[model samples]
Target chain A: MSAPPTPPDPTSDAAMTRRSFLRGTAAFGGLTALAASLAPLRELSDFSSTEQFLQKYYKEMTPSDMAKVIARIEREVQHQYGVRPHVRDLKPMDGVEFVYCLNLTRCIGCRKCVHACVAENNQSRNPEIQYIRVLKMPHGSMDVEKGDHNYKDAQVPDKGFFYMPVQCQQCKNPPCVKVCPVNATWQEKDGITVIDYDWCIGCRYCEAACPYFARRFNFTKPEIPKDRLNPEMAYLGNRPRKMGVMEKCHFCIQRTRAGKYPACLEVCPVGARKFGNILDPESEVSHILREKRVFIQLKEEMGTSPRFYYYFDK
Target chain B: MDPRPTRPGNSKSSRTNLWLGGLTVGFLGLAGLFLAGTRSPRPARADIPPVDKKFLETTPWRQTYADLVKAKEDLSDYDCYGCHEKNKPPPIRFDDKGKIIIPKEHANIVMGHGSHDRNDLCYNCHNEQNLETLQVRDGRQVKFDNIPLLCGSCHGPTLRDWDAGAHGRTSGFWDRKLGEAQRLSCANCHNPHSPRIPPREPAPGPHTLHETTPPAQPGH
Candidate 1:
């Protein structure tokens, strides 16, 4: 049997005042407008997932954790770029100290190394990031202050100019590593200064501290074409970095640690670039240090003790 | 609808069969002719001549003395004694301007090595007694592969710098324990006839985001 007809609660309709309904509608309208105003944030590409947020610091992660992290990175890269990347976390070798020596005489101001580094490192293409900067210095002056970065000569090694390709010097006393508030960047045992991109807070202190102007900051999401993405990547080196992270040359840690020459050194047409372990006395860098004359650090007074040295052929 | 007893050969089905048989034979004959025509190989890629492939080359071609030796055994390509008299030394002739007249055979080579044509003489490096060997200024005989020693005789300081890793290009591994490191010879980079490094077109410069202002001058 149907129950006796229950009386409607007074608050259901009788208690709803016109003024109360108007107030409720105003509140709902305000919330909708606020949410609509936040639509631009949907375009921000650097939104972190739960997994990314909970990832451990580079030093704290164990071998198993690193493997999982690398797998995750590969999966993310594949999802974003439609290409599976070979990402690795290469450790620095024992009893090795890499040093770079640039022969000032041989460099013809050709910017091959600059573009090669960009291609090898998976650097951004649109807002165009490059690791190496080739300077055109005047013939008579040894001072770099007289150098020009934007010499648009049809042929290189212009009669009165010399080229100097500069990147991260991997200094013994790196100021970039020192200024990291989050301890995201540090110098390895092999003297290579590296950054943990995930751990960086993007304060850009390191960028300010870098004396050589080596550090590059990503103002927006890096736009890498699917075809141009380098399949080979390193966790601390050439791996694709996210927005708001700082990146710089790590001496091509991916290749050098695997007993291969840096991309910049390999692509230099004139062979102005020289890279080898300074620890090995028989290495080319050692020979250059022992015999070459007029070895000049970019800023000796800064006392960075850079691993990179430039010399003139007297 | 009209039922009638038809003759076997002139029947529509037999006529169609004949047409099908003729078509099959004609197709088979054409296919057999095509197969026979392609059976003999007429030089693979004969139409495509070897491209110079120098468009992308930033540096000059590698023509090292060692490479020359590896390319041809017994050095028949550079056999000076193959044409000249084995016992007699090749005669040296000079033009009116005191410039050594390189023979028509060696016209491919340009002689402008040193200033004032001081090193235009072929005998300066080539051994006069044995055409197969090279002689340094100190009268020590060297082989074709050992052109560095021959070059080092006059370029003593440059040789010392090269040995010490101050000159030329060194490639391969940085650590000897890890892998092999190769140091290029003098001829690998510089032409023996003309040691000067030629000018090259520079790679494209950086394209900055903001094109309004000039780029920051790099100080290095």
Candidate 2:
């Protein structure tokens, strides 16, 4: 160079290059930080596959599409649990509306129904996911807030305490169904609130929306023992759910739709849990609704209009 | 236009100090989160029973008297003809205080029928005329399988509830159009000798995910 160049004036265009260089450096650093922050996404354990990502909504799926989807699920289940599960998408029966009646006096606070539900449904054993929560309420009290489910008594029917098992009420006007931003959950014609696990974005808005605390979140990949996995699964019922999805008691869609009593009803030693079609005048549930005194719906003030009813036959 | 004005607090040295403080706080927060995330799960309570095969097994202790009779090959095991004459009712001895002295041979039968032990007489349920038949209050004869009829005579309200499916277990199918609805008889659940159902051990409570302590009451 002929002569050393003098320092550029602070106000001159000559200083623009330095300023631009610093700006470029800042931009590069910001981009690198953003990339580093997003690195955790690569380790997503339950990332959706291309097929699952592209799957249509439950209502939109045709019979053929449903069959293909079921087959794919069956294959995936076989690969994971080493067992081929029979996954069928059962449609709601015409002229049938399900109603459940619980005889509060007959329930002896025995949690047999709870365990039976877990065994019937392919729920995770560790970090156990149970739909039914049997609350032990004090005598002369109907308030649910005063109830406790964690009492570890040597024998049930604890003195001065009665039992009330709570689950999805299957509301006529379901708040959970309405709050779903993704429309992943809906009430079927049979009055059963069903969740489409595939379409769920794991927002947990429905869980918050529910007043009875019925919905459960798959916080992690469900850990069910191979032997404990129920092979008789329905697509929107007892089928094994993946991580980051919402699930709840579907009133045993697979069994009830096929005209079989739910596992909870079958196992209840006291015969407290009663389920039947309200449409049939001769049905047991109809007779119960007509005859039983002191019948009350859980949280009727919430305007949920639950299909489930509790009665005291004194 | 220059958006940031040079204030006393926004000086170069103060700004650098603020950046250092922010970085340190961020690092500490991340470290705390990492520790919390990596912490081991709380040990399960020893008082809680493990959900084993026995705990999970559900044997509905309700078998109809008719079904039990049909299953038994030896009718004499439950038949009145085994110990007494077929047509005549067996003679029962009474103590001085009017309590029936149950024979040692039938020690298995506990006579605690009513709340105050009022309906404990053998002839009250079993027919004195014909030992094979059950006697209702109206003298209507009921078979062993139709014990609900015999029990219904006294427990009219319970009988009405049972008839309307408000009482007793109705298993099988809820919809009778599709399958049979198997309704359990009254004697299936309650022992005729002792009508009160005994207390039973409840199944294990819920073990929630990532909870160190016992699961807090849900939805409270």
Candidate 3:
């Protein structure tokens, strides 16, 4: 009523109005007012500019940090889906370079990996993020599937269509990094590139600049149905992305940090995906890329130096 | 929230009502929360139908929830108590002197540990501690691991096999290069409570046990 006293600056990002503060700590006992006030509990699909105001991308958000971010996500999920979704801690590996590989020959166009990726990364529903694109390549002609993945109109087989899934290369020298007008997107020491969504001005330069077409923009405030949301959230990668921002595949950093394989690699029905640390010579991905005759996406020209490698058995 | 006052009415009554409403809601909310916190830790097995009754035997197995299979017609329908039970089938059996013994059937029960020596049980490494505890990282509290950790007790050989990938299942399919590193849980392969033994080698000639072992030579 009286300028709401500026919400008292949130008292160092932890303390709040004593009423709400005590209520959240007592959430296990059901802080009914806090739950009722914050849950919003509606089908929050309308991605208006109003939502963009509330949604801060990774770069802008600092204090309430990853824990509060996850807590907010869990509360939202619990309110919407009646299930507690877990947001995982997706952090870059230390001295462990993340790399991905696809067996283009084995991928059979079955979208099990896509569904797995959607669930594991906690991407929004209704225009879900397919971290890996499985395009139907023309037989004996790599040129057919080499085009963009956004082909519409019930992609039935024309003649000899083979599926090829494309995703972020976690490139060694990512061009998208160079193209950023603002220093919003940067590569981590672990060889993975990340975009601070808050810092991004929605300029979409990184999306266009990526040679592999790995980056995606949030045209709307992305709405994840509580039921469909994956709880395991990462910090920079798939942590409930906001509207009017750009995002891309993060190689499931959270899962990898915890000594677990990426969700897509785990759920591939045909074992089409492989992931590991490239720096570790003993890592599976390193051995595969070293031993196998692997093909890089656009090996000749762009020279972005992507970490992703592909091969198919003859 | 700024009050844009849709209707022009009261100078004092509406404001008083708003504050009163806020206080009333806050009081009730806090009261309910306090009641919930003070409630006792729930008794685990309060849900399953009584074992004394022929409920388990009469109920036909339902495969809906992989963790649970009940033998009852109402299972397809519903039983409110089933959830309280946590679907824990009655603790299998006890031994002499009241110490609950691991069943021999459990020894043979390998969920899929054939790739390893299939004798490990659930509690080999798992104890009372560390279950359901949350590890806070990056301001988030995730679990220790998804699958229940166990079977590392007496089978150190298998543990290393699992960690380094000489043996044990990967989460998905087998690969020659990547196969050795991605590890899996002991339960992914073998059933802990009821396990199976390796089949005996067939007798020679489908006849008697007349086949003799090769003589033990002193040194080859």
Global lDDT of each model?
Answer: 0.78, 0.81, 0.54
Candidate 1 yields a Cα-based lDDT of 0.78
Worst 10 residues of 3 chain A by lDDT: A40-49
TM per candidate, chain B: 0.65, 0.69, 0.27
Q: Kindly list the per-residue Cα lDDT of model 3 for residues A197-281, writing each as its tens digit.
A: 5467788988888767678777655656665556666666666776678888877766666666777776653455777677777
Candidate 3, residue B171: lDDT: 56
User: Lowest-lDDT window of 10 residues in candidate 1 chain A?
Assistant: A38-47
Residue by residue across A1-314, what tens digits does model 2's lDDT show? 59887656655655554335445445554555555455545435244566777899999999998998898889888888899899989999999999999989889888888888988988877667899999999888789998988878889888888899999999999999999999999998989999999999999999999999999998877778888889999999998888889999999999999999898898888889888889989877888888777468999999999999998877
lDDT tens digits, residue span A1-314, model 1: 99997655545765564434554555554454455445444444334556778899999999999998898888888888889899999999888988899999889988888877877798887667788888898776767677777778899788877788878989999999888989999999988999998899889999899888899988767778787788898999888888889999998888898888898887777778888888888877888888777468888889899999998777
Query: Runs in model 3 with CA error above 4 Å?
Result: A1-90, A144-159, B1-169, B172-220
Between candidates 1 and 2, which one is better according to lDDT?
2
Tell me how each candidate scores on DockQ against the true complex: 0.16, 0.28, 0.02
What TM-score should be assigned to candidate 1? 0.79
Give interface RMSD for all predictions. 21.9, 6.8, 23.7
